[model samples]
Target chain A: MRTLYQFHGGVHPAEHKQESSAHPIVMAPLPTQLIVPLQQHIGQRAKPLVQIGDRVLKGQMIGQADGATSCAVHAPTSGSVSAIEMMPMPHPSSLPDLCISITPDGADEWITRTALDYQNMNPGEVRNRLRDFGLAGLGGAVFPSHVKLNPGKLDKVPTLILNGAECEPWITCDDLLMRERAAEIIAGAKIMQYLLSADAVLIGIEDNKPQAIAAMRAACAATGFEVIAVPTRYPSGGAKQLTKILTGKEPPSGGRSTDIGVQIFNVATAYSVARAVLHGEPMISRIVTVTGNVEQPRNYEVLLGTPVKELVALTGKQRNDTQSYIMGGPMMGFALPTDNVPVIKASNCLIASSPSLFPAPPPALPCIRCTQCAQACPVNLQPQDLYWFSRGREFGKAQEYNLFDCIECGCCDYVCPSHIPLVQYYRFAKSEIWAREREKQQADLARERHEFRLARIEREKKERADKLAAKTQGSKAPAANADIDPKKAAIQAAIERAKLKRSGVTPKNVENLSVETLKEIDEIEARRTQLKQAMEKQSDSPK
Target chain B: MSTALLIMIGLALFLGLVLGYAAIKFKVAESPLVQKIDAILPQTQCGQCGFPGCKPYATAIASGEADINQCPPGGEEGIHKLAELLGVDPKPLNAEHGVPKPKSVAVIDEELCIGCTLCIQACPVDAILGAAKHMHTVIAKECTGCELCIPPCPVDCIQMQVVQEDLTTWKSKYPLHEIRNV
Candidate 1:
């Protein structure tokens, strides 16, 4: 038996896996309309290739990937673009995003498909093809996987970890996936290993998921892949924790697993990769565990953009006390604003939340400083300290405690005897810091623009002066063009003449000058001082 | 003992010479006080503070000629920031200047605009793009919601529209969790 490693600060939350893991995955029926958001993962939103009223085929690329950090969006089925407008997204903030609403024609067609022999193609081509296919990390994070696949500037990676440790309670999507599509997961791992040129491939499934382990082990019989059943612990499925458990080394603080010569992918992500690369299918659906408060707590291969209400309808009846739906696991998931919102790429679990099923947490008490929260923090951060700092709005002190490193896994909340929502504090603090950073950037941009404008105004004034001087010289030979302009420069010099003649200006040329000339000189004198100030500003700005 | 005292005096003189030279070498031309005040002020360039722009207002504040609560776009938060930096007690925002409004960008109705280039001159940040006889459009990102161009428009074409909180601009609201550690 290969020696397994241990990660600090883990809790064995009650595994309610039996509710959903008992049944096999089933395909959800297609909806009448699909609202596809153009954003993929974290970077720039994808640009729409098809206009409204354009016909789209199944697996057709509708939204083009924007940059190296983004991925494409494909048509879920044969449809015509009805509208491209802002629609509510299935996110905690309940904000609307630009979405392509397609009315399906029900032909259920496919674009011309060709399998990729990844072995024959270069690894870069394979990764790029996967990006165009819109393959992202399906296990909750929805980050574009192509960026992770490229081991840039690193020696041959040593370990490839497939996280089959679906450790969140009441969520069995990954377990069900490993049980059924174990071969696909193995194939995907082999492909990733080839790309990474990794020395070892390890798939770590939690010990609680016995059937998934057996299925995965049987599939890996001659594949040179090792299947290890790690001790079931909550948040072991977290990439950092899983990476640490599979390999003794931890990725550096404020860094990715790739930094430590290891790259981890969720098992569901691996299955999607295999389907996309080998079968040439785009990401259109994911296995969601519709578990809480339903008659049949089962897993379904839910098509992206299917309403949560429709999927909940397939689960038979729900308890009357079902107040809301919480997307993802109870620990890290947020309460969905409405069942009307369509499921997106990262939604792995949808729990019909009710007070009785998962009883309402009682009113919280004051912290007694028991250190239970600190003990249960998977990242080994001082949760109590973070909580105090965050509550007081002392962001700098919280950052001093390394606030950004927190994954908001809710392990601290789970173990808090005082029932404090530790994760929420961390989340609020993180968002506050991010907002401040954005504000600082905006301030800097505004300053730069204001300075640039000031400089340009000065340059324009100088150009105007030079032009006026040139015109006066040019016109002096024509018809004494010196009448208006040199008259202006002559006035510009008279301002300093004003300071000298403070007590009394003895009128020498005043008798000969016309009334219009005197008025023009007064106006020009005012402008000359303004122009001098503008010139001074040109030298003041640094950039 | 006299020789030791002479050596100490010589050492002190040498160190003082180095210190004096270093001060002259690394001398900063101006205090950063005005720059810090400017950063706290929102660059609205609305001229509600009786100054031409945020930089002018900042310069006045640093010289103690202007009060700290003159900005409306910066709001009470700006007042507090200025107070903290200058070591003075924070005061209520000066409502006489103008009431604070939600962050918004100016939108021009193209049909109503007469291409007069008046609003373009009024804009401090130069966010408005237009030629003398062409339709003017506001660059939404560059706009600071200053409302400076509104009065200058001849045709009443420009309108201040609030920037709604969408996904890109949305913030996770506070007090989301019931369990406050305090």
Candidate 2:
């Protein structure tokens, strides 16, 4: 086995994973209602093609992707669309979002799904099928899987890295997946390898999850794919970090693994890809880790878009005095405001802990420059400088210190003696900068529009003035249009000068037409006309 | 002469023992909390959090050295949690955690979030919603109060808001605060 490449800094957080990994993936009994957000994936908000009263078959595309960046929303269970309007989404603000409220018929029947034989179909076809099925990255990313599968240049594809490093303290869904569905996961890796035309397939699992690692290894034994165990570290599961650990390649700053010819897919997403390609599943359900201070901490095969309340209830009620309910794990999870919100693609763990189990935070003090955070950082960034800039709202400075590089893994906050919410400050600075930039972009667009409008108006005014002057003077007159032009006379003289130069002809010397010159020409013509007229008039008058 | 030297040595050893004991006896109990503040930070090695990582922040918090509202990703929630933990009165999420938007993390519309990871670079808490041009998501809980995510959202797909709730746990309004250690 090749030696694992370690990143700079990471914290050894308490692993609460044993509580759930001990158990197998259990299926939650069907709920009466499934509230699926139409905009579950990170993309264009899905457009609802089904009405509130319409009946939908399981796995049917209820909502279509509004644009390329979006995904299709499918019915997890056969049901009637209760509402196609905005309802509360599982977010930190508890905001209302577009959702499909399905009243399950309880049949759990699947709609018609298409399957392509791998024997004949190419990688592109496989990708298109997944795209049509609305498959996405299921490991909390919820990215469209089809797009990731089809890198622009297949020939330059790097190793296909399967991430099974469930490094968060309490999340065991991926571990459970590796244990229960190892074959499927390996199959998925093979499919990804085929899709990307990867040279080799590497699956990275944390050493702590021995069972999962063993299972994955066993599954990969027959196949040529290799599964490697990595030392457990908080956020070792991060894509960039995992990529670096597995391949010894650092994704370029603000660049992707694909940019360097590598593509990393979460174990779950790989499994889904395999199943979707092999079994024709449409990503209707996923394994969720429903643990944390609940009565029964377990992992469940939850259908996509199930409401959090139902899932929590399945684990049994909070023991009366649960102080906080978090969605995801403790370190990186949000304290849920209410349970009415529906789980979306990224919803992984729903944690409800009593005050006793999860105590309230301690009071904070000022920074003593202990440099402990620096010691703990995995990315080798100077968090103190970033914090200084962030607190001062110097977003530009914070960014210069690689503010965007901070992963919010809670290691700094977790290790801080001062109890300062350092991540919050960075988040604030980043958001403020983004908001300001957005405002600037909007302002710039508005300015462009305003300038264009002014120019248009000026042009129209000039044209209107020209037309009015032409009308006032005789329209047929050569100089009529020139009356409105301030420089028309100069322009005409220039044209005459050019013509004279081209033809070698004397330019019309209007200056030579003096009073005497005009009088002589007029008198000479008058005398000749008078003599001829006098003879004719005399004859006519006699007649 | 030998006896006198022995006596002096004995006396010196006795005094050293007594001083050590006195020092140990006089030692003050370290605050239990100082250790906790260190444990909650993301420890990204990306030092956006003015402190080094979780431990330094913890030390500062325990010493009454740091405010509870510096983290941008933690936003109002982190501030509230810190305030609750420290027994300090919770203030509105410091405007500095960026405006406390709906707990929406950046979600790469897969089709939109352009995976340019401009959002990823913009994300102070690394809670942006995508990967490089692929879809990314904000680990909702990990996001700090900072909206640094909004800038790299090339497609304007990232939205910050609160996490969702349901009936089992969703109370129309939160219950009054009754501090219960258990």
Candidate 3:
């Protein structure tokens, strides 16, 4: 029997997960138009490799990985690029970003596929291949997997934790994926363990997901990997939370799991990695849970960049009383701006909301200074203090209380009787702080540029003054002038020639000049006399 | 009586010397108040506040020659910060100087630009890139929208354009509350 370690405070929100977990995963039909956002992961946006009007085959690399931190983006199916323009992104902000829109030809043709012998290949090469395969944390963080695969400073990872918790309510994609593709997930786990040289592998599944646990356990038996069933709780699926539940060690403050010689990956991510390594398939699709207010609440293996409206359509018509749609789970999901936005890599669950299911909250009353939020905070942060600091725009105080560690799990909001939107305030403060830092950097850059310009100007002025002084002091100029660069030497010679020509000009061609030429010369002489008068006036004035 | 008086005078002299030495030993070179004030300034260097640059304006304010409300780029938030730093009541921005304007960048129409190099000299931060008789372009990121370049352009090719608020630069509004969705 594998022992399970418990973490700090966690709430057991009603598990609506079984509504979708009971059904088998289904492949979502390809939509007419696909909008592939280049920046699906938490890194630099991928650079587009194809232009509008270009034909792309299924599994073709459409966007190349831009940097080591970013992952590549691939075409979902055979299609022609329709528009490379700004479209709404699947984020809380719902702002338009650069997206490559494609129109499918319905041919579903694929590019040539060849599996790699990663065993003989170098680890770096395997990681690079994974990046090109567009693998990211399919657990909804969407962090580039290649960056995480590197052992970093750790000589050897002690334990690799596969998070099968799927703790959030109404999110059952991971549970369904594990139950069906347990062997593939284990294969991917082995690959990751090999990459990190991990000594042991432990799989943590919540007791509520009995089927998933049994499936993963049966598959792990062959590999001698341990599968532990942890208690069902909200946010147990979080990387930090699950790491604690399995390994009983907390990653130090502001550090990664690898800092403590441990690393965790979502079961869905493992499944994708196995697919990429064994079949040469890029991450063009993912399993998404479509539940809540729909006739058939089930999990669908949906293609990447499929519009939310189309994917939800496959789950059948939503109930008539639906009020809104949310991405992610009820605990931490946000209201989508529109259903027209295409699903990106970060999307995991799409829940249609109704008045009865999610009744509107009462008006926010004053903070009663209650300590319920503090007691429920899993990270041991004082949520009430963070709320006050964030609400009052006292970001320094918020930071003093470790505002970033709150995790925005909405636990405080869940327990707050005042109905205050505490998490929004925290988000606002964090973004504001980030913006201020960026502006400060810009100001420093400007100061440097301005100071450099001033210095250059002063240096040039002194050099010019010295040159004029030499010319006026009876021309005892150095013979060293001859050794200067040809460009400067030519400039000096040109000045001398111009001076000579001005003092020694003769009117040899004046004898054959016509009346018009004589009139032009008279005009030129008048203009020069005006210029000389202006110069004399400037010299006569007092300094 | 004369001996007693001389002894008292000697004690006073000794104490005065000790005090003078302590003052010199613990003396600070300068106050950081000026640098702190300068930091609060937006560093636009636009000269709208009757000073040549942000540093000069900061110096003037430190010496009580300039008011915090004279800077248009800094706006009301700046005035409030300056007041907080100096421990004085916040004052309205001086409209005689200028009103606060949105952040902007100067764009030069290359077609109309005759390459006069006047705009280059006018730019306090040297954001413009060009040589004599060559088309100049503004490094948009470096431009502080000082409007100094606009007046110096002989062909009037320079224009101050308000920077667009896009996703890359978007920030969440403070305390944005909707229908109270948790």
Candidate 4:
């Protein structure tokens, strides 16, 4: 097989992965309860299909996808729903969200399942199966996998890239999985290739993990796939950078690799897909890397809905009064507000380091005109220019300088002599731009609605005038009244008496209005009367 | 022999004359930064920087006699701007000079004031307006809150309260990194 290419601009941070990667992933004991959030993936939140007090089995579909860009949720274990209400979710704000609470049956048994021949299945069938299994990109982005797999255009994909770079510090779940279940991961890669229908597949691993590279190479020997070891770099794990490194192709700034006839999936996601497609199993659980100042830093294959607090406890760490706990890695991870939020599909690692190990950053000073930041910037942007423009609220100028290209990798901030929070400023500027855009869109919507309302009112007024003129003409001319003879009047009077007897609508007003307006007004009046009647009925009923 | 002697005498005389003329014609002024510092100071003639007036303080700063953190009325904001000009970190305000307060100069609490002229003499900027037996009121525009008048007042009527947080005063926390071009 032909060798792949490489890209530039990545840093090498200390990979504290030995503790977890040293051991094979072990299954975690089932907890008594599981808190499953409906909104785990990137798109629309799933709608709950089961109510409280309903019994659910492991791998049973519990929540249905709400929209086209959503994935369904499944029960990770056999349990009964205790409550479907709001609880604290893993977010920076520590906000509450609707989640499903289930009391486990403790048997750890699987529900009925059937495997589909994903290779022979048509593209549509493959997509439907992927959606049914609720598989998303396990690569932190958590974008629904089926959407990427089924590109809108039917161009044949030439290459499929498997990412195993795990470049982030302290993340070793992928490494451990590769070391233990290399064959499974490779099988998963083939499944992805089958789904993408790519002619070639390339699995890129950093050379630092010799064990994983060797394991993958051995797995690839029989599989006829090529596993290439790229040089170790911090963000070589980023989808775009890794794709470029492996294929020597640059995906446009705001485009996907599928645009260039390439699709990239993480090793874990591929393995999960393989299991779902071949073994008739859904993505009920994933391996999580629990590392950092804990006494025992290990990767445990945990259920999907297990709480962070339990995972931390398994690592023998004191949770309370800790300096900070991060969800991914210290550089790019979000500060988790609470430990109660369950581990969703996107979570790969949890780092709970003390303040002594990672102290609060010291106060910043003015820049001393040293060009180190510019040199360290991965995107070749002028960090100094972005800083000046962002500080002055010159967001337009900052955008002109390719500010969005900055991956917020924290390399510049880490090496800055002034200890400046460069990433925060960029984030603030980006959010501000988004807020302004949303405000403009809302204003445009309001203007459109107002114009539509005025046009509607004008049309109605013209129609009412035309009707009045027609009615006057009918009353004046004898020929116009000929159709409304005594026999028809008798039938109309009978209908009116019957409508009065019924509750929905009185017929007297129907004669006064045009057919269209009468129908609309009748519907509105019926709804109002029904609502009023229902309110009265409710008031009269016992509470 | 006489012609050679005359030519050498002429060359020597010409070189000496040119050196003396150049030395007298072009003399660059040394340490011209003092005038630049004087120009940047808010020449309110407010005498807020501890020396007799703005020019004196400017001279002292240029001569390195006075530290940069002294002007209480100018406050830390002013000190930062000064440090930028001087190419140094703006240190915290020295507690001994005077504490920074609001933009307000000073107001004489007429009811409590003992109508003394001590404050008038203590005002370095001549900001106080009064005579011997009359209450000394501060010329608000001229007063620089050097707090010089506060100690001299027998009745202790002077107070330096902070200005409120308003739209203009609300600045974002400084950007984490301010990279500059070399």
Indicate which candidate wins on TM-score. Answer: 1
- Where does candidate 2 stray beyond 4 Å? A475-543, B1-182
Model 1: CA > 4 A from native: A475-543, B1-29, B176-182
Stronger candidate by DockQ (2 vs 4): 4
What is the C-alpha lDDT profile of model 4 across A78-142, one tens digit per residue?
98999998887776555667789889988766877787877677878888778878888887888
How well docked is model 2, in DockQ terms?
A: 0.01
How close is each model in CA RMSD to the real structure?
Answer: 13.2, 23.7, 11.6, 22.5
In model 1, pairs of residues that clash are: none
Looking at candidate 2, what TM-score does chain B attain? 0.44
Model 2: which docking level applies?
incorrect
Number of clashing residue pairs, candidate 1: 0
The candidate scoring highest on lDDT is 3
TM-score of chain A of each: 0.86, 0.85, 0.87, 0.86
Per-residue accuracy of model 3 over A1-543 as CA lDDT, tens digit each: 766787787888888887887889988887989999998998889999999899999999999999889999999999999999889887777888889999999999999988878888898899999999999998878899988888866667888989898888889998898899999999999999988889899898999989999999899986978999999887788889888888888987778888888888899899889889989999999999999999899999888999998988888766789877899999888889889888888889999998888887777877888888888778888888888898888887888889877788888888888888788788888888887787778777776777788899999999999988967763455555756665677799999999999889985788888999999999999999999999999999999
Question: In Å, what is the interface RMSD of model 2?
Answer: 15.9
- Rate residue B177 of model 3 by lDDT: 46
Using Cα atoms, each model's DockQ against the true complex is 0.28, 0.01, 0.30, 0.03
Per-residue lDDT, model 1, residue A119, is 94
lDDT of each: 0.87, 0.74, 0.88, 0.78
B119-178: candidate 4 lDDT, tens digit per residue: 876665566788988777877645555566888888898775443432212333334533
Please say which candidate is ahead in lDDT: 1 or 4.
1
Among all windows of 10 consecutive residues in model 2 chain A, the one with the lowest summed lDDT is A442-451
Instruction: Return the interface RMSD of the candidates, in order shown, one decimal each.
Output: 3.2, 15.9, 4.5, 18.6
